[model samples]
Target: MSKDFYTQFILPYAGIIIKICRAYTDSEEDFQDYYQEVCLQLWKSRENFKGDSKWSTWVYRISLNVSLSLLKKDKKVNKKSVELPNLDAGAPQDPNPFNDESLKLLYLAIKELSELDRAIILLYLEENSYQEIAEIMGLSPNNIGVKITRIKKKLKTLLDGKIY
Candidate 1:
């Protein structure tokens, strides 16, 4: 990609990249680290981008791979005393009248979902269609729909009736 192309096409999607990183890491410092790592990966992979896929698709794939690796590192650091399920799973319910505090609670809830589910829910909420989501997730659109329904039910249970 040309420098101008990098500046225009790629940089604009930084927000999406950051959101994915934030969803994976709770702390600002951790978010920054992961965010940088994802960016670096994107730049490294940019030359390989054949324009066969959307730039967003290529970047999303790289970012997801980076996030999953970081997650594995986290697990190793913590050790498997009690298996830590996905954060979006086993997360507390959302408090009523959502505010900053409640929003944090919601993210905590989101973190409970599996990484793939997290990607689905995020892309869904961001208005990506099942077809697009399936593309990012390497699943069929039918499978994406089924997984999303299950994810919604799980999120509802976790967020229902919980105070922030």
Candidate 2:
């Protein structure tokens, strides 16, 4: 049953997991940890799924929540300084599908955002509608719209006015 669930549900949504993990982590090791934790939480909570939202939406919510939880725990455990990504370093040390400089810069900028803002932007970037994003984020559709606009402006300022 676990194997079937993994293949049928988790594998199909690995990209969503990866994106959320990358946004929440600073290093390859941390990224791997976040990814594993997200998958584990999803599997553990498999029976809790109620089909109230799409499978993809559930995956997004779980992935984001797991990443945020782990990030908070890590911060409390060790107050470490964040290292900015060296854009001129070419490809990242980790296996990242988003290796382009622009994408890397965008992610770096996103990392500077507040947790909720980061989640909102990530969901928006995934092309989730405001309504769907609200559903996953437990926000009202109107709130999601306003938050997305504000998040985008924050990101642009972070990117030195570059519209990502």
RMSD of 1: 7.1
Candidate 2 stretches with Cα past 4 Å from truth are 79-96, 161-164
Candidate 2 per-residue lDDT, tens place, 1-164, comes to 37798889988888788778878888766777777888899988888999988999989989999998998999899845466433234222335556677887899898899999999899999899999999999999999999998998888788885644
Best by lDDT: 2
lDDT of 1 by residue, 1-164 (tens): 36786577557787677667767876655666677787777777767889876878777788788987987897789732322222232112223313466666667898889888888887787687888888888999999999999999999899998744
Query: Model 2 compared with the native: what TM-score?
Result: 0.87
Q: Residue 6: error of model 1 in Å?
A: 5.3
Error of 2 at 57 (Å): 1.1
What lDDT does candidate 1 reach at residue 4? Answer: 80
